[model samples]
Target: MELIESYNSISESDLLIIEEKIGYQLPVEYKLFLLQHNGGRPVLDGVRYENEHFDFVGHFYAIRGEMYHDDLLRQIEEYKDMIPKGYLPIGESPGGDVFCISLKEPTEGALFHWDHEQANYDGEPWEYNMTKLSPSLTVFLEELCVGE
Candidate 1:
């Protein structure tokens, strides 16, 4: 996927701090993407959720963007309990649902979507609450297509 508009690059030191604060090693492919384009829209529009498709990837949070909603670190903490354990918020649909990366064994680096309407923040993630977007971030980018 291509970044349409993005912020400046993040230094390795800053990235390290982010990792430390978040307690997970950032995916390498994602780190490369961040170094080139901290946050922005993918050229390919909407992403598919199960059989339903929505505005692909409207926006991603920058490592240190001025906007609260577009701030990566901020979103991480805000959505911490909203998402399953080890999942990191990376982007979102135009409707405000979240796209995240699985940080656990077996699904590490895989992309997932948390439906705002279906999720239960107080409970464990159920199949009804989550959809596997792609096996990996690379594959997710590859599957992206223009929105309606």
Candidate 2:
């Protein structure tokens, strides 16, 4: 996938610090991606899943940057309670939906789309709000297509 407007490159150590703070190890390919691209807008921004659902990625959150809205750490903290455990918000859609990665087993490394409108913040099970997007971040990037 092609990415543009990426932030300043970050070191593996920076990722390690984030992992420690988040209390979960990031997937291997995702870690490499952060080191190389940090975060940026994908040229082929459209993502499709569940046969018909579609959305365009706005921007991926970055690790080393002054853009607070696009800061990975800040996004994580902001969505901690909103997002269910065992997942981490890494980016967003223009309409405020979040893209997250599964951090625990049985679904580790998997990517998901979290629909904010359908989210449950009242301690109800959130499985209904999460739609599996891809088996892993690697596949997710490869599958991104140009939006019409």
Q: Each candidate's root-mean-square deviation in Å?
A: 2.1, 1.7
TM-score of structure candidate 1? 0.88
* Candidate 1: tens digits of C-alpha lDDT, residues 34-135: 787898988887686665665468888789843667889999888877777778889888888888888888888898888888887567665477777899
Off by over 4 Å in 2: 65-67
lDDT of 2 by residue, 12-54 (tens): 8898899898777878978898988999999999998765548
- List clashing residue pairs in candidate 1: 45-56, 46-56, 47-56
Reference-based lDDT, residue 98, model 1? 88
Best by lDDT: 2
lDDT of each: 0.81, 0.88
